[model samples]
Target: MDASELLEVLSPEGLRLLDSLPPWRASDDVVSSVAALRRQGHPPERVSAVLTQARLRARAEAKFGEFASRMLFTEAGLEQATRLNVAARHADRYRSAGLTSVADLGCGIGGDALAFAALDLDVLAVDRDEVTAAIASYNLSPWPSSRVRQGDAETADLTDVQGVFLDPARRTSGHSATKRIADPADWSPSLEVAFGYAERLPTGVKLGPGVDRDLLPRDAECQWISVDRDVVEAGVWFGPLARAGVGRSALVISASGAAELTAPADSEDVEVGDLGEWIYEPDGAVIRARLIGDLARSIDARTISRDIAWLSSDERVETPFAQGFRVLETLPLDERTLKRELRSRGIGRLEIKKRGVDVDPATFRKRLSLQGSGSATLVLTRVAGRHTALLCERA
Candidate 1:
């Protein structure tokens, strides 16, 4: 949102209107709500601003949960903001290290700063954008220990800060419709500057999960986190904030709970083997953290191919690190043969998964002309240097 929109949203009347509005829903009659508010003597701009906030709050629920209702967000800020649960873990690192003060440089809408403040740490949340900083201030208003300011993160006054959390703006500057910055140097607080903070104090840098691994520091502990099967962020920690004896780690958070796998460094790939009774798909976090080998070994499995992430085992093994599927049979990889085979099996509802294959599951499925009543998973992958299809069931 722009500065004017923000001003309208933050006004007492605007906040009251936002609070009074019913929970936002995709099916809600937005036009009617706008007309009603306009007829109630609310200015068009104020109504629009509050309604935008209501919509943003609805979208923010996935990241912030109930806290989102009371929080403010910009489209870009909400998109880049860390998940509340994940941010709590980041805050815990500082709390565990006995760090009482933290400077959250490039803090977008105070996602991590809220966690820090919630943990009672003295927080200085800074953002270069005035609108984002203002929104962050609003989100963090409940925490007296937290403060928000508009300033360049690269030049933020560290002063007596004990720890630093740097989330460099990875996108072009804007409250909405921003584009990703391809080069790290183009980032608002460049990677170089963000990493520089680690040299001076206990620091944690949050980057995209797909960030270049070669760019990571050898001395820092890099952790990849996935929430509900989606790989979210790669956090690199240095100094006391870095976990002991851990160079790479994957943290999987799901409804079940959080599980972590750590190693001193990337684990060596396991030897390739023939297709076994079961296939295991490692969590995205595990793959991103390059700990797939470790996960495979933990479950007494082996990779199906040299570079593919899929693993196989003779016996069924249950682990949070991976999803296990039982192989029912094998089918020819060719489209016509696969279609014939699937039709024979009466498979209709199909879940397609592939690795090291050129086929797009959606496009391939359409070509199959599926018309059966059964449901099955088709895993198209390379096995011992050959393309193969494994018909599977959830284990």
Candidate 2:
């Protein structure tokens, strides 16, 4: 949103209207809602701003929880902002390292800055966008230890700052709707410059999970983070914030809690064995961090293929790093044989999983003419360099 729209939303009249409105639901009637707000004598700008905040608040709750309600957000800022819970963990590194103040360059909406301040650390939160920096100032108003600025991150003077948190804008340059900028160098402030900062001072750089491993600095601690099974962010830590002797780390965060694994480097030298009684699908974070071998060793499992990430073991493995499923039996990969086998076994519902070999599950499912009452999990992958299918159940 523009500065004018934001100013109106933060106004007393606008806030009262926003607070008075009922909670926003995804299925709410948009036309009726707008009509009702107009009937209350609110101007179109104020009404629109208030309604937008209300709707954004609902969506932001997933990331910021209750704090989202009190915070103002621009659409792009909210979309790009690090989840508050994840930001807290990032803040802890600075606190634990005895760093007193941090400069969060490119701090969209102050998500990480808020966490830092909450943990009793000082913050210099800066953003290049005018309205975003303003919103960040508003969000961080409760903390006297924090300051917000509108400026280019590369030009920020952090001489007095103890630590640095750089989240270069990965979207196209603008205060408007964002589109992903594909080139890593095209990222605002540049990844090259970010790594330069890493080499010079205590720093953390946030990047996409798919960033080329070869591009990662050799000395920094690269971390892959996954929330609810989806790989979300990869952060590289430098200086004291960097974990000792750890070159790579995977952090999995879910409602259950957070679990982490660290190693000096990624490797997949473990033996690939024949398919066993149970199958384990490693979490995306684990795979991305190249810790599947580590996880396999932890669970006493072996890989189904040297190149594949899937793990298998005869005994049950109850680790958060991977999902374990018990195999029922092997199935034919061929269409005619698979269809005949499914019909004979009376399996109507199927959960299809695939890896290594790329036979479309949807098309394969459609071709399977079934006449059965039982439900089954079908795994399609390569075993001993041959296309193989295994029917399994959740362990």
Which numbered prediction scores highest in lDDT against the true structure?
Answer: 1
Top TM-score model: 1
lDDT digits (tens) for residues 1-395 of candidate 2 = 88799889889998888888888999998878889989988898988888989999899999999998888888888888899888999999999999999999999989999999999999999899888899999999999999999999999998889889999888985555779998888888899988888766799999989888888988889999999998889999998999999998999999999999999989555799978899999999998899988998888889988698889898887998888889888866888888888788899999899998878998889889767788888889888778888888887
Residue 50 Cα positional deviation in candidate 1, in Å, after optimal superposition: 0.8
| Alpha carbon deviation, residue 187, candidate 1 (Å) | 1.1
Per-candidate clash tally: 0, 1
- For model 1 the local lDDT of residue 386 reads 89
Query: Which sections of candidate 1 miss by over 4 Å?
Result: none
Q: Estimate each model's TM-score.
A: 0.98, 0.95
